[model samples]
Target chain A: MSAAEDRLPPLRRSSGSVGRIALIVLGIVLALLLLVAPLAVIFAEAFSKGVAYYARNIVQADTLHAIWLTVLTAIVVVPVNIGFGIAAAWAVTKFRFPGKKLLIALIELPFSVSPIVAGVIYILLYGANGLLGPLLADHDIRLMFAVPGIFLVSLFVTSPFVAREIIPLMQSQGSDDEEAATSLGAGFWQTFFRVTLPNIKWALLYGAVLCNARVMGEFGAVSVVSGNVRGETNTLPLHIELLYHDYNAVGAFAAATTLTVLALVTLGIKTLIEAKGGGDPHRPRH
Target chain B: MAGALTARRVLPGFGPTMGLTLFYLSLVVLLPIVALALKTGEIGLARYLDIITGPRVLASFRVTVTAALLATAINAGIGLLLAWNLVRYDFPGKRLLDALIDLPFALPTAVAGIALTALFAPNGWFGAPLAAMGIKIAYTPLGIAIAMAFTSLPFVVRTVQPVLEDVRPEVEEAAASRGARAWQIFRKVIFPTILPAFIAGCTLAFARCLGEFGAVIFIAGNLPEQTEIAALLIFIRLEEYDYPAAAAIASTVLVAALVVLLLANWLQARSQRHSEKTP
Candidate 1:
């Protein structure tokens, strides 16, 4: 009886249906135009001058240096964040601890703080007159407006991704496998490498991919501390800004297109991993 | 035997874990926050109030929060529609469209700013048409709002999409079978389930827009009273070597963000409890 009732006739057509459809279509079209069209225009213009100009612009000394700096920052920020993620996940999931709730909130602090705030705090602590400034100068070490400053801010901005991803995965998996490994005479390190690491690897990778994207694309925080010293401190995003301001639209787009392609590639990898993980129940563990 | 052996081992538990967490937090997060608070403290409360309440800062606060709120509100409605369509409809290019939503997340903010500026400048493609109607976008508060909305749209869409997907269609079918109208079913059945997720998304987007800098600065033209956002104002202060003023402004944003985040977390917890009790 319920099955027959569920097959009731479809609703009658009304003028309101057209209006609703139109509204939804209009909203979607406007969003696509706003978000996708600008990038489209940039890509069109980049190729308008042929591949030679694109190649020349992207290979310029300053542009290349900026790209290198961006890559270096990603290299530094991603692995360290993954390590932090693993350790945090281990502590949070494997042990019942005091202040657990507070610690969880603290782990996500970077997510709530503005990138600009991250930059400001770094400046206040490491700039010429900052709290640690005098002490650092005494030791002849520099952080503000240097590579370390750039890396530090990037680290802060992308800090939450890995831990955020891995913690829940760890919690859901529980500690049965670790216990079994321990009973089999495995030490802490051995259990972690053999049992825990494999279970949370996908979450770890997902987090790393997300972290890399943010680190590569981060602008506000890096700009505040970078001093924008041309080849010396300009990352790819900063370089794009400077080039556009200098009326070098082609160069800016060339760099942007490169980053966009990188982003798409990472997103593809994430989708593939997620799909694979979904197909096999045990796959999420690895 | 296994239980006895496991119980016998001393796991280096809470003390080590808390110590490690605190050490990392202090080095990376708490210390910098303390420095910001300390710098603000140096300029007495009276002077700090003067800086925060000055005309320029006040204008920035009004503009940033107003634009963020407006954008987040718009996104909440539109993002829900988009999520609903994506989950319910079977259309060609659906996967492609879904992928495009994440473009803003992947695109660098500075590049986004530049691209938007080009598209909306007086001589640019779209600007040519809009300028005919005496509507200017680039280098205005309107342009700032548009940029903020563009970058922040994905946050709401992504947040609500999964929730919408999880709201099984069978309930809607059941409601319709009972002779309920479409709007009534949507209002009574679908709306309550997704409200918490929608609010969470809006809060995140609003917080993000308030702190946005790279995308706003290039298109805003950074005119002091007219288009300077709070984040850019902090940048200008730092550039002028006014650490105290910058700190004061930053602290204001920090406190505001914390309040919003706390409220959002509470709502999330409440929703979780509600679901647990019902389901």
Candidate 2:
């Protein structure tokens, strides 16, 4: 018998197969218990009273404001990173550069740095006694413990996503298309807008999706910088914490459920994108 | 060809690229790092050492490293098994299982923390059963480890999955033809091939655990010199307005992370070289 057949004999024999099937079933059950069941509990608890309770708690002014702040932060952070991503990818993949390795490493620094550390760095740079703090104070400027501080920390944490996504796509596609465009008399801007952008468009979208998810979900960095001011600086994640601590579990779970739903939707979208992008013959060539 | 050649030459190749790269690095990465170093310097080397090597800092480091290492080790085995099952098996709910693996990547850390804490608290459904066995999870180091493991599991699973899929089944069949037992074939053939990817995944998971804060903070109970992690310690220092001390602690963490990253890259490169030579 083939090795595959030999391995299957135990399965074919109902008596000996019981143990193996049981083991496989146990593994699946454990994973479900650990990962899925808890989420089910959270959702059930949130909606236990009714949709009215969820709607009322989730639509409260503070919760609404936190969600709005989170969306605003995503708006501010995603675009800046996308721009930085385009620039960095253009520079790294399109050119043979000195200090290229160093630049790549620097771009990835945020990935390695703790989000809490990112918050700390911003505070050191913009807090009242910070290096830029006195100069800002002279100008009556406030960066920390405010909206800008939240945005800044979000920026630091999510900066690497777009660049990382674009770099590999650009590298594999090469510079031939751009050169051909330029030869065909397309100007730099035109070449970029026409050839380069179209090619990296999918990657750019994927990166932006990832960046948006992270910025909205961020907690540690924003927590340190925002000072958790009730309605002023609180983001959704922080709002959940505040409500939970206040024994407002329903409100907290309502906010949590909203974020969770958003996350699940993003995951679904990402899966579809990956499936479409995977092994497709339509990818743009060098 | 002539136009392409001139474009290559006149397009301001390495020089401009290097200049932009350095400028960007200096602005966004190096400057902040330099500021951290200088702040630490202001406290003098002795004081910096004192703060970083203090009892609380030392305890945090020990706990963080211990928990991270244990979690990564556990993940390396379970992640590889899961990858193997996903790639080789034709099971029911396979699609659902595949999608579930990425949940940690998308779930907000704070929400995850809350969910985990609710499930593992003494009164929590899961925790209550375990608590009956006299094992405490919530507000303890075990809870920290579980949270880290939960968040970091995807890194290992995803990293190893693609590699396993690429490992053609024919090789395993060949080993079997050579009279190797199933376990033997796995150890001698499949294990070596997938080992590097597993290690890479473990390293990524370890680095993540080292820096994990959001989920851990909720469950770790944040006791000084006990449940406190390095990230929490840094946060506490910053909250107290102890910039110098915070910078000192952060620098130490940064240096440790750099070392792990270097080791990971080195292992990856070595594995690639081996594969290239063999093929």
Candidate 3:
């Protein structure tokens, strides 16, 4: 038995059989309990009230408005963020500049800041009692407690995704393609559209998908600035909170079901992108 | 030569792209941060100290920190196990399991909060069994920790997975051939290689948990002096039109987050150095 064990290659060398089984079982149980159960519960509770009830909740005016608002936010936010991301990636990757590291860190600052703090800073800047409050009030302009406030905070929260995704990718790939195209007498737009864009397209999509998902599901920051009007300013995540608070479990879960599906689709797209050899969107390139 | 080559701009869009990046970064991020600083400064040092040190606020900080620490501890262990399993074992549904690790990141925090609450509430699925044993999860700090753990679970697993995968099997094979015990090999070899990433991941997860609001509030029960978190207190202060108070508390959290981010970056740099030296 000892000789046979020695004859086995190191890769085939087993830890104690009982220990291996125990570790696997523990891993599976933790994943199932911590990660999988919450997901299963969302679908289960969403449909707990039957298809008619779930469907009715889904199309309710408030729910529809919330969904619409979330879509509007995503629609406006994702494109702007994508533009910012591309620009930041371009500057950071292609040029040597002073304060580049600081710039990258600043771009990543929002990811570290609490979303609620994100909401508060904006309110301090633009709320009715804020620094610009009097100036805005004179002109009847509202940024906080309005759609624009929601947009601003959402922008702050998801600002890093696109740039963070593409920067490392662009850095690793180097500026060779862009430089080559430029040296070949290609204009900026032509090189970007034909060369730089193709190389970073998947990463850009990955970033955009993540950005859109966060915008739709954003709760902490949006909750602060939205003013929580039921059918008016509420986004999907806010709508779910409203329903849950009102003891409308079915309604809340139904709304949650929509966001959950969005989350799943985002994950699916992310996995597909990874399979297509898009760089891992989150890791720093060593 | 390399520095000179890099110094010469090779791309024409630098002027346009760099201009846009700075302009947007300022308008969206820096200006608000400056506004926050101004608000906090206007509140004066005494008032800022008083508000942040009030009993309720302090209590909430304790709860937030304690729960976050607990959650980070849980994540480090489970995340390591899962990362190790995924990298080493040939299990059925491995691909699916790998995908599931990121569910926390992709799912909305509010959705996660409610779903976790439903599962762990006393009358709910997991809660019922545990309740029969006289232990409660939801509506307690334990619940808050669970929410934190759920939201931050991917940090450790994702951070450690690549490092573990990079641990050449040949090294392990050599050790095994030399009759090193499995535990000894792991402790002496694999553990050192993955330590920096693991610690960095935990720090990040801890930082994230400290600021976690949406996923935590639903399950936290939001009781003052017991279950309330610092982030919710900031919201409460804001709701009451106490802008100065909210700003003060938020400043503290913000400073802590920045400190944590700096630490994480340093650790990551160190990890990179370690990998480079070893390779």
Candidate 4:
């Protein structure tokens, strides 16, 4: 019935029926080819070798290690970024300060930077011949070409997600609630926990979800830094690259299926958050 | 004197939060940029120019910029169409189509890279038909543009959607009441309002394409002077242990990205101000 209603001509005509059909068909075909087809290809290739083959490939020790390392990186990167995000948002929105615009721009710097350049920045700072490299060498500390390097670059890449979400939200919500709470004899922590946290919780979680996805899927910077040792430092995306280069198409797609599942979950949560009225922070209000 | 003249804030966490914000910002962003600058500075200006202007480097820049431009052009058109349909029409699977626009952003670029490459490779689904017609997509600059377009697809669509939504129905109604045709209403009434936002979205999409790495590499085929992108070139330089050359090439890319980002920011701000002024 709804389909029949959609097929009916418009009560008020902005575009002709023929033009409308043409445009909708064009959009759908493009979405199918550009968006849906890639996902279909991943799942098809992943299961092409049979369910048993796919399962066996995923459970391999190296692949399992890659999964674990990827999870570990997300665990570390997400919460720290959440902290930074909250702090940055809190300071930017709740207070008047010097160089406020500059601070916001700086926070967004990672988003604009090429990930390979991000990797090189660290290399310039911590690689063997890097400025701090010699200094760190004397101390026998390793940062680049290791797990720590992976964590750092992931941090750089995802640093803005949470703060970017919250700053606009907190700004819109205003300081009135917190100010009222403070006047009512609430302490800082009490006001923040009871007032600010509750108000911004959904946006905070939305930001954290995005930050987590980026951390898990980050490739270029992590590739440049993580020496890509099979069981030692390879994250899931890096492992997929390694598998692909080795012509293990099934293994690569198999591992990719996991990240694919994560991407779907992220999209689901994003839609849910939007439905919950935590609407996309980046979208302008009507 | 200026600092002392302002009244104190009533907020409690300002000191601590600002402290943490500045501290972390320096460690994560500012310091690394400083490191980049220091390294680039170490390579004298003459050598820096020499490295960035080298024949291979110049070719990669040409390929990267050209592909990015092509991708941005496609994104501008398709994104505008998609956003228009999404905001203006209701179809059977409209909501699902809206949700799927973000797939490129959420999906790991490596997964996107391999999936796209498989689809466009000679024996793959789309590839077989196109190859029969003597058209090739994978392992060429065309593939690079397609990959760039895939990754940056959401930028223009997402940016334009809300702005389009904000174009009040009354404006169109007013035009319609005046006996204006559909195209006239759009071209005159609607286009003027959304132009700043549309341009902003295109600029941002272009900037993102310039920096895109993971999704482009697998399909790029990494030929030295032909299909290679700037980001890949920087990676190759790093692999060769030529730090100076890598830093030099990266400096150029970095500066371009920053400048483009600033321009996009300015355009977005202008759009916001424009919207506020409208109603």
Best by DockQ: 3
Error of 3 at B161 (Å): 0.5
lDDT per residue, candidate 3, B1-279, as tens digits? 674666544679889999999999999999999999999999999999999899999999999999999999999999899988888776668788898889998899999999999999999999999999999999999999999999999998888888888887767777777898778888877899999999998888999999999999999999999999999999999999999999999999999988987898799889979998986
lDDT tens readout by residue for model 2, A1-286: 5555665322232233444465557658767876797577679668868999999998899999999999999988899888777878888887774677877888888888887877877777778877678999999999899999899888888888888888988889888888778768887578788999888877788778878899999988899899889988999999999998998877788899988998888777776766767212111110
How large is the interface RMSD of each prediction?
4.9, 5.4, 2.6, 3.3
Best-fitting candidate, scored by TM-score:
3
Model 3 Cα interface RMS deviation (Å): 2.6
Using DockQ as the yardstick, the better of models 2 and 3 is 3
Using DockQ as the yardstick, the better of models 1 and 2 is 1
The DockQ scores of all candidates, in the order shown, are: 0.47, 0.43, 0.64, 0.55
Off by over 4 Å in 1: A1-24, A278-286, B1-19, B168-170
What is the C-alpha lDDT profile of model 4 across A1-286, one tens digit per residue?
A: 3654433324234444788888989999999999999999999999998999999999999999999999999999999999999889989998887899989988888998998999999999899988789999999999999999999999999999999888988999998888778868898799889999999898899889989999999999999999889999999999999999999999999999999999999989988998887747335210
DockQ of candidate 2 relative to the true structure: 0.43
lDDT of 1 by residue, A81-182 (tens): 887777777788888757888888988899888788899999999988999999999999989898899999998888888888888888888888887777
Q: State candidate 4's DockQ.
A: 0.55
Candidate 2, B85-179: lDDT as tens digits: 67766678877787777777778999988888888899887889999999999999888998898888787777777666666666776776677
TM-score of each: 0.92, 0.92, 0.96, 0.95
Worst 10 residues of 4 chain B by lDDT: B1-10
Candidate 1 residue lDDT tens string, B34-120: 999899899999999999999999999998998788778777777777777666554556676676676777677887887788788
RMSD of candidate 1 to the truth, in angstroms, is 3.8
Q: Which ranges in model 3 have alpha carbons more than 4 Å from their true place?
A: A1-16, A281-286, B1-9
Q: Mind giving the per-residue lDDT tens digits that candidate 3 earns over A126-191?
A: 998887888999999988888999999999999998998989889999877777788789998998
